[model samples]
Target: MFSGAQISLYPMTDDFVGVILGALGALDPYRDKLRIETDDISTLLVGPPEVLFPAMRDLFVAAAASGKHCVLSAAISRGCPGEPDDPICRSDAVGGPVGPLSLRKDAAIAAVREADVTGQPVAVQFSLYVMGTGDHMDEIYGCIDFLKQSGVFDRSKHFCSRLRGDAGAVFSTLNEAFCRFGPGAGHVTLDVTVSANSPTAI
Candidate 1:
């Protein structure tokens, strides 16, 4: 059995591609499977677990160098085709004025309001599907609760199971949330998507 991970990063603008792709090139040596594709501002990648995580770390650092924000996702597999999975987390939740610590429910809602052209009572919806040995529901909630305290959201617009806020805050928050559910250095695979419309699932 083997498990791998994938990363799809949405740049703030199209011009950021050069920086993202360049980072991936520098990070390729860390993974056996590495590929980069773009659609508008999104960058996609697929590779083994070990290489994937480190590569993502590098990509995050690369992204931080030029952009104001970034979102990342990781997964692990117990069976299938890949390496072992690791559930241990080492990323900081709150690092700066905009990091995890800075993310609050009210602040989250405000960011959406600022970004939305409609400016109508804005709301964001999403569903999380996770697979692993232990039940990570509590850990998931922990992330959401943390978001609420950060003053970045307005109490989760629709469903408040996971988290709700600006697209960027939600994505980055989810990136940290999902990391909690990864397998313990085993083999795992993860996919996270963010869109204007979403189904109600938790």
Candidate 2:
């Protein structure tokens, strides 16, 4: 029942260093709850999905609040056979008896609807991978159906689906997709890229 994310932030501005450094403060509240390590490439956050997504949301929102175009790319995963399990990474969000796909979708949608609003608008595109399962495609398709019904759903892209809305809902939607689609205790990962205040957005 381990979970975590490797995330990187890219700010388009002359003061990228300043923006990045300042935005890091947003993770202060989550410091005690997560094992976070930053290196030259990305920051690795090891924690429950409940804390992981919000931590990422706050960090990205803080950076975007600078009024600069910002992109946050993340590789989120759970139940990886290669990674040793840590008690800090345990969470109720995932790992349990599997339920019907339709029921999971409904619950996921409800969770998104109840998500807190952050006011900062963002767009996200991501692909979900439900590994170590024979019915992986079925799970992915089920997740796609859930996304389309999600209020933030924008469109379906070539290799991924897009979501646009307030940061809260967008991240909540991502959390649900990561938690609900695949086998509760199986290996699942998300490849996500989020953007805010993009100058070239149309």
Candidate 3:
């Protein structure tokens, strides 16, 4: 059972390099808890959901705080059979007995409600993929139901859903979607893009 995200940040400014470099400092608190590696394309963060979402939120907030439009794109995944299981990725959020879908949705909503509030506001669009399952659509539909009531949900779009709200709630909702919809130990992935301070937003 492994979990992680490959994330890239793009700041819309002449000083993109400065914004990106300064924003990375936000991950300092999570350094010990996650295995982080940055390359030209993106940064990989391998860790539990508890630490993962917050670390991302902080980093995004830091970049957005620069008053520059910013976008964060991420490919988040868990229980990937191809990847070697790392102890650092261990978390209660994965590999557990999955109960009723109704119950899981309830629990996920509760978790999102309790997320720490960040002042930054963001909009995200994402699609969840529950791989290697015959009843994957059932899981995806269930996740959709959860999102409609997630408070952060903005609307549905082609091939994905849109969410808008405080960074805390938006990220928490994403975390829940990743953890609760699929088989606890099965391969699941999320294609996500988040934006803040976008000049073209309307």
Question: What overall lDDT, based on C-alpha atoms, would model 1 receive against the true structure?
Answer: 0.41
What is the C-alpha lDDT profile of model 2 across 18-117, one tens digit per residue? 9999999999999999999989999999999999999999999999999999999999999999999899987888999899999999999999999999
Candidate lDDT scores, in order, read: 0.41, 0.95, 0.94
Clashes of each: 36, 0, 0
lDDT of 3: 0.94
Minimum summed lDDT over a 10-residue window in model 3 is located at: 90-99
**lDDT of candidate model 2 versus the reference:** 0.95
In angstroms, how far off is 104's CA in candidate 3? 0.6
- Model 1, 109-136: lDDT tens per residue? 4433433222111133333344453644
The C-alpha stretches of model 3 lying farther than 4 A from their native spots are none
**Model 3: per-residue Cα lDDT over 1-202, one tens digit each:** 8899999999989999999999999999999999999899999999987788889899999999999999999999998889999999889887998789999999989998998899999999999999998999999999999999899999999999999999999999999999999999999999999999987886
Candidate 1 lands at a TM-score of 0.38
